[model samples]
Target chain A: MIPIILFLAPALAMALFIFRSKKLNAVVICLYSFTHLACSVTLLVHPASYGRYFQVEPLNLFFLVVLSVVLAGISVYNADFTLKSAVPARKSTYYSAAVLVFSAAISGVVLGANLGMMWVCLETTTITGAYLIYYKTGKEPLEAAWKYMFICSIGIAFAFVGLIFLSLAFTGSQPSLFFTDINAHAPVFNKFWLKMSFVFMAIGFGTKAGLAPVHTWLPDAYSEAPSPVSALLSAALLNSELLIIIRILKIMKIADLGGFASAFLITMGVLSVFVAAVYIIRVGNYKRMLAYSSIENMGLITISAAIGGPAAFAAVLHIAAHAFSKASLFMTSGNILKRYYTREINGVTGLLKADPKAGWSWIAGFILLCGIPPSPIFLSEFIMIRTMFGRGMWWLAVPVMLLVTIVIYGMASTMFKMSFGNPQKGISQERFNILNYAGQFVFIAVLCLLGIYMPKAISDLITAAASLM
Target chain B: MTEVLIAIFGITMLYVSSTSRVEAYIRVLAVQGVILFLMVLLDHAHLEVLNLVFLGAETLLFKAIIIPVFLMFTVRKNNIQREAEPFMPSFYSVLITTAIFAFGFLIAFWASSNASNVRPLYFGVSIATIITGLFIIISRKKIITHVMGYIMIENGIFMLAMSVVGEMPMIVNLGVLLDLFAAIYLLGLFVTKINSTFDELHIDSLTNLRD
Candidate 1:
């Protein structure tokens, strides 16, 4: 009961409070984050206590931890992030509500046992996140928000259509759409409809997951959205969508649709890598570049999931690591935007010279994002490569390696270019931005520490979650 | 009997292709919407009363009345009325639509033998309508006309859903309604925004972000 309330309270409070006082959204988001983190910890310690509507399964428990930690970091940064905009009153009133709703919707998506319920939660994420995307109502943001809404709405609609088809596939003594029920009887379902449904589901949820071909909306959306929301979009929101795919992948295995589905996923996943590789090179906007990098990481995870076996474990671990590292990177980028007043790669230089705190965080973030050593992304990528080779798909591993290398050079060159050259004239020095700088450091430190030493508990949780999938 | 109405609905696309006036397109939407309402009523009369009521109210309120009325209001508000110029000549457009419509029927007919349980008439017409909507969206320059194109595609999807399943979870139905309504509202709002921001709502002007 408490866990259910923990999930519901944020959205409810956000709705009730935002109607009256918008500035309270940040405080409400913080309260929800703290309470959620506390509740998830409690639920983790006593698995029997979380009730039926909600449970902290080892898989979702790991996601819950990632979500809470990232939310806390975003909440702290938003405390100051929201103030920088001119409409302080509106910012305060609306920011927390948006965050709370987004947080609740994402948590619900991860924990949902029923597919219909998951779809509703995913839709809610879109409707609420649209407001955040359009925070300033600038032309570019509006364009991005429009694309996000229409594309996602269409994609989700296709997902629903797939669900209906999946229901049709369950032609047996008793048909059910519940995940548990489907898993129980997946062996006997019609192969054709199941294959068709998986295709639709993969593309539908994959669009939301920021997988390639259907990923045209990500760079526009993530780059234009306010920084904290981008963090949530890349970190928590993408994970929830991946959770749905993971669920479907499990079903495919049980149904013996494994080979076909894995081929499809690998094909799309590699296409995403290639697309991200091409686009990340010429992107002059730093924020857009980061958004494209997210596309690349998501593709890597998809391919890893296709490889399965121990690599599935690596995929889940990569999710956790990427969530932290990307959130930290985007937040630090926000700090840079504050000092430099530009997101253009060429506009601001000498970040170590101008603001060392943000500059070094930026560089370190690039290192982790590029899968360099000591970062958990590096560890996860290495394991995935090993999985590919062991599976005798040496050619597949080459593209994955090549794409990663290209993206690394792409991001490193951009960051190095932006962070080292002489400070361009007319850049303002921001003194009151100390807390934002502090928030970035704390987030980066968490990622770096986790990379250096994975605690026994977290590793246990990852292994357990991988087995369940 | 249902097949006849479905055919009329498909033929309306041909009529739509031959027209230069935006008013005629709206009229096509009005006719299409009513036809969809009737088709739903005929097909689902054997369903549970609660389901029938829900379906009836959805078609009557949203499809037939609300959406068309809303589009009409937006049309009136954006007054340079008739869309006289089209990218392709009307004769060629009609010929192309006819070919597409025939192709849609062929595919649906081919598929029906495989999926013998569902209504092929519904499948064929809906696919043709969806194609026509795409055709109009591509050929028309006016934003209002494009909105019309979107509605036609949405109507096709609705008809297809009804014909195949004949029943949907009420929650999904509600969601579908909410999404469509919100889409129109947002698109309408953007149309207004575009009109004021730039001198007109030409989509070509939104190309400022290109490489």
Candidate 2:
């Protein structure tokens, strides 16, 4: 019953938007967000119920909570952001509808018990997200949307090929693609087909997760998308894609193929950090810089999962923390864009004087992103490094630490320049609605609170989620 | 009979690789759809009536009729050039695609010798088609060509799925068909938007949003 409502809330919102009532857009969105958050929380407390195609497990519950929280934040920010922006009423309604569908699709991805259903849901997110990215259609946004749709569709098609290969891995009986059924039969599965499936799934879903080599569309889409939508893309969407990878990794572990899966993850992780470092140093657009930062964090999460044990625990924590902090950073960046009207880093300066609320938020968000002390990322990275030492992976730790340091330096230096300087001409001085800061403050407060002390119940939830991984 | 259809499907990929006209690509896609439809009909003997009807609609109506007509409409409405304008020459593209086909046959041969469950011809031709589709995307400069490449990949996947048709549930098959239709429709919409915004459909014009 709860699951049906969870899915229906957004579907109902999308249906309402078809009527094109501009005034009710915000109300419908807010109502859906609250309902989603409440449903996620209820499921978290009592997760026994099941749907035919979807289920609420520990790992999915954690992800659902993170998605709902970030989505709720985005909704709050969207309420004010929409009224102030120049989007026409019809487009705004369309944007709201797309966002609702996007959320519903991702919710489906996380909750789906069947791999094929997950693939379908993930593909739906791509289509809906492209719509959201093209919300304010122009040359740049349209290009970003095109690349996002085309590249991701091709990648996901490869994943479907991988699913076929996965089906091929089974013998003596027809294979079922339900998660539990696959896990039960994984030991007898053909290793060759399994490896092939993993590679295809990695590249396919990796494109969606913004991992390296296939991560080109990410920065473009992130930079061109409206700020609230960017927040969702960076904060929520990438994690949903990673959840699929983690699910596959579990099957690999059960098949005694954990080493093979870990090796691929470690390689992609290191490569992503290296890629992020290279782009971060020479980045021209601040929004693009944040996109690269997201790549770096996702890479770290992959590394943490690859390292296993306590590191997996840290990885789940980092996902939650990064969701809040990154969403905050993106929301604040939207505020900066609203003031400066340019994504170019050098185009605007003296953010401190221009808008102190956005500036401080930007600085705090960057610090949190860089894994500074009191940011949950700091603890996650620290645990991952310790796991490396305990596992005698000194060779891996050295490069990982070095690349992380380079990324930190690159982002901090760039952020410092943007946050503290003389106010440039042509910057808008309009009074921002206090609601604009409301979401960022909530995200920041959550990050700081988690870093300082995690409640016992939440810690238990994180531990249970990690154990499943 | 199934092998003959699969062989014909494989041959159409070569035609796709060697063609410069967008219309030729669409025609080949329609042919591939028809071949796939025949293959499905030949292979499945005891499928329920509903599943057969669904598969028929997906392959015949959506893949063969709806998609090609949609692409033709898009090409006409956008006034895109008739030529695909690939980065590589057609002869070289054909050469590479043939090489991929041979390589796929080699893999199929090796797999069949070692495993009884593997369907060598289906695996070989489908993989060859997929690789050729990716090659088309990489070697082409036009956005419309890329869409065609994507469609070719989808067709390849459909062939692969058909190789083990009885194993996958009806829901999964329907989901895959629905996703393919949605992806192609959305891609067509984007191509039209790109044509209007950039006033050109070339992939090179899309470099404005880069880092």
The candidate scoring highest on TM-score is 2
* Candidates' RMSD to native: 2.9, 1.6
Q: Report the Cα lDDT for residue A298, model 2.
A: 91
In model 2, how well does chain A match by TM-score?
A: 0.98
Clashing pairs in 1: A22-A92, A22-A93, A23-A92, A23-A93, A25-A96
TM-score of 1: 0.92
lDDT of 1 by residue, A1-469 (tens): 3455345656555474546543455556666777777767776788643434455578877787788788777777776776565675656566566677778888888777778778888888988787788786767777677667766766776676577557656655354556878898899887766886898899989989999899988898888898888988998899989988988988999999899989999998899899989998899899999899999999999998887998989899899889888988899888788778888888879988888888888998888777787788888999999998998999999988999899888888899998897787787776656658665677678777778998898889889988887
CAPRI-style grade of the A/B interface in model 2: medium
Model 1: residues >4 Å from true position, as ranges? A1-23, A48-56, A173-175, B13-21, B84-116, B127-146, B164-175
- The Cα RMSD in angstroms, rounded to one decimal, for candidate 1 relative to the true structure is 2.9
* Residue lDDT tens for model 2, A70-118: 9898888888876666777778787887888888888888888999889
Assess the local accuracy of residue B52 in candidate 2 as a C-alpha lDDT between 0 and 100. 79
State the DockQ of every prediction: 0.29, 0.64
**Model 1 chain B: lowest-lDDT 10 consecutive positions:** B166-175
- Tell how far residue A66 is off in model 1, in angstroms: 1.7
